[model samples]
Target: MMLHTALNWRYATKRMNGRRVPDATLERILDAAHLAPSSYGLQPYSIVVVDTPELRERCQPAMYHQPQVVEGSHLLVFATWESIGNAEVDQLMALIAEERGVEPASLESYRHTIAETVARLSTPEARHQWAARQAYLAMGMVLTAAAMERVDATPMEGFDPAALDEVLGLPERGLRSAVVVTLGYRDLETDWLAGLKKVRWPRDRVIVRAE
Candidate 1:
């Protein structure tokens, strides 16, 4: 059943009909992103859901005028935290301590370790890069979950990150756009890519044995 479920899913979406995806389905996709694993449990990113037609129209230019930006039912903009500062680390450590019922004082050693690690990457650009990697993990999880829910999705990296950040006002929140995924039902009639075969390296060629 698991194999069948996965095999039935493919990234063949190019154009999406204007039909809207149900809110519940979208919620499930977002929930999957929330549950995705991240380094140090920092969760250094947030998912921005763009469902309104007006907003999508505005975002189209940022996405290289891609039709899917406005045609899809929803556009999920993955934004990464701008910087990893002491405040952020402290908050995460505090939450971990509280959630695990460990003494806050016991986590002082961990706090110092994490603080020093973040301190080493002092520039905003470096921190953003780290956060972007975490966002990609969430993006992958969202795509897989969409497939499981029988929804079509397109993982796009062709957008102008700076423009998207400006349009979405992410920079104001100390976040930067890392990636975008369009979600909806695929338009089989107009999408040529839908009919093309998916190409990938064979498992034998891609996977290497440790021995």
Candidate 2:
């Protein structure tokens, strides 16, 4: 019934009542994100959880003054590595090789192939964009996990990335904020979307099959 639970639980939460989400629930959401798939098994993203009132308050301006930024019990900021360098690729390959008991030389060759793939990227921006796309996959997983736990969430894309990066000290880690989600209990009174019916494209129109 896991799939049924997932399907029955998902919703784009509109408002949060500021009730604290338990650490256990939060960790479950993160575990779901950790299990998300990524390209080449190279997970190039990290989650930044902001639980402090002061930090969330400071983030409001960066989030275009979205009240949820300050009202939600927690802010999950998804960020991706700024650049894919040789050292990072080498590290991943080395782990894969060791786990598989492969020769270092063979691993080196594989690393070269990965490097070539990265080099073929049109620019650093393209590479970062690709990584950000992976981050979005993880974001989707976390959002669904939150919904499954009966937690409210708001996926936000309107924000000053530069300001958030500076505030979160992401540049120091060679990462940049790609997206954000606020999670907590919903404030039904103020959440206009809470009572509205959700609308989506018909399955026939959105999905195509070739036989």
Candidate 3:
């Protein structure tokens, strides 16, 4: 019920007040993102939180000088792996083994299933696209959590990805920027979209039942 309320209350806030979300609330939102499901349980992405004014200023241009980029309390960059391969699968297998208290050898079959998916992707571009989808899942979680916390969040894909990646030096780390989110309280007086009704397709039209 709370989630439904929050979803209805939230919008892609265009302007944000200079109010900072509490550190505790920020943590919970991030935790929810981390718990987001990923293909093969391998989260092939990382979140870059830019809270410093200097950093936000540098990132603003990359994001086409979007007001929320620098106006919000923090900016979240969801960068997915540039590519996926056996190395990544091995690392995930190792983590699974350690966390589950099982030997790596025991998970060979499961690892092969993941590896097969990676192999089918073949090209780096294909793999990157898949990784980007996983990043979106995490971003969705962040949006939901922020809404529930009464924090305003704006998810934007209007930025130049190459510019943003360079601004954050993501390539060297084998990462590519997929999406971004800005978090803060909305500026009700200045945000024109504020106080406006939320619009959506009627459920019957949006959700089609399979015959």
Q: Who wins the TM-score comparison?
A: 3
lDDT, candidate 1, 1-211, per-residue tens: 8745754566758898988989999999899999999877889888888999999999999999988888898999988887687999999988988899998899998888888888888888888888889899888789888888888999999999999889989988988888899998889999989888778799788998988
Q: Show the colliding residue pairs in model 3.
A: none
* lDDT, ranked from best to worst: 3, 1, 2
Whole-model lDDT values for every prediction: 0.88, 0.84, 0.92
- Give one digit per residue, the lDDT tens place, for model 3 in 7-106: 9999999999889888999999999999999999989999989898899999988999989887799998999887688999999998999999999999
Tell me the spans in candidate 3 whose CA falls farther than 4 Å from its real position: none
Pairs in clash, predicted candidate 1: none
Off by over 4 Å in 1: none
lDDT top scorer: 3
Better of 2 and 3 by TM-score: 3
Q: Could you tell me the lDDT of residue 24 within candidate 2?
A: 100
CA error at residue 145 for candidate 1, angstroms: 0.3
